[model samples]
Target: QQQVKQSPQSLIVQKGGISIINCAYENTAFDYFPWYQQFPGKGPALLIAIRPDVSEKKEGRFTISFNKSAKQFSLHIMDSQPGDSATYFCAASYSTSGSRLTFGEGTQLTVNP
Candidate 1:
């Protein structure tokens, strides 16, 4: 069973701080790992991602650290801000799925000003 689970459904951090979230998966069939950021009322946009073959990937202020042996992954946000407040979803799927995504429940991040 390929399932992805996330922790800390919500997070509160002051501006200029760092926010961390964790995720775990159950299946090895998943080949594509992606993190998505969603605003209040819009579709999720790709944040960062890594393949099972990679250990880490970083984009702008966002980073994804993947652990293939443990079948786990995580998202790290640096220098967080109120403007960065949003919901984040960690997802995984096979490339063969044609980008079809299986997502974690979500993490709502609140950056206090």
Candidate 2:
């Protein structure tokens, strides 16, 4: 129940379009959900996150929709731009477990100009 499954291994979106990525988890014990965006040769950086208490959270053009009951969540990027292209990952972990995170396989997004 510690696995996080992500889909659409790759995605291509035109500039100004919206990019969507989905993820699901099996662990109900998980209380912290965070999304990370990584560029080539760089470590993953925290983008946005949500707790089970919040059904949705948005930061600028990035939004995260979470369904605690379904054990699923998704990330949406509005008005995607070429500069936004990167590999994104969804992760889950409990705060008590230190900084260790259980991550999804990852989704590569390419925004075309």
Candidate 3:
């Protein structure tokens, strides 16, 4: 079974709008939640991450909201811009789970100018 699941196989947003992507995990052992952004012909880069200890984490226009009890998390892009257009993925892992990560299927995002 897929440990992590994400919604909205694709998304489109206008500039300066809000783009939200949600994720849910079945493994309670997952303690680390991270979001990655990838562009064509490039590898995914870690955009933001959160630990189970925090309810939310924000960096610039990127934010991660985690719900430990619900085993869910989401990424919210505020003031979305064309530069932010990319494929976003949500991942979950634990210290004991080795270096591998359980990733969501990914959401393709398009930010229109």
Give candidates' CA RMSD values in order.
Answer: 1.4, 1.2, 0.6
Clashing pairs in 3: none
Model 1, 1-113: lDDT tens per residue?
A: 53999988999999999999999999789999999999988999988888887788888888899998898999999999898899999999986778788999999999999
* Tens digits of lDDT, candidate 2, 1-113: 44999988999999999999999999788899999999999999999999999999999999999998899999999999999999999999987788589999999999999
TM-score of 2: 0.96
Instruction: For residue 73, give model 3's deviation from the true position in Å.
Output: 0.3
lDDT of each: 0.91, 0.95, 0.95
Model 3 bad stretches (over 4 Å): none
For candidate 1, what is the total of clashing residue pairs? 0
Global CA lDDT of candidate 3, please? 0.95
Write the candidate numbers in order of decreasing TM-score: 3, 2, 1
User: Would you give me the overall lDDT of model 2?
Assistant: 0.95
TM-score of 1: 0.93
Per-candidate TM-score against the hidden true structure:
0.93, 0.96, 0.98
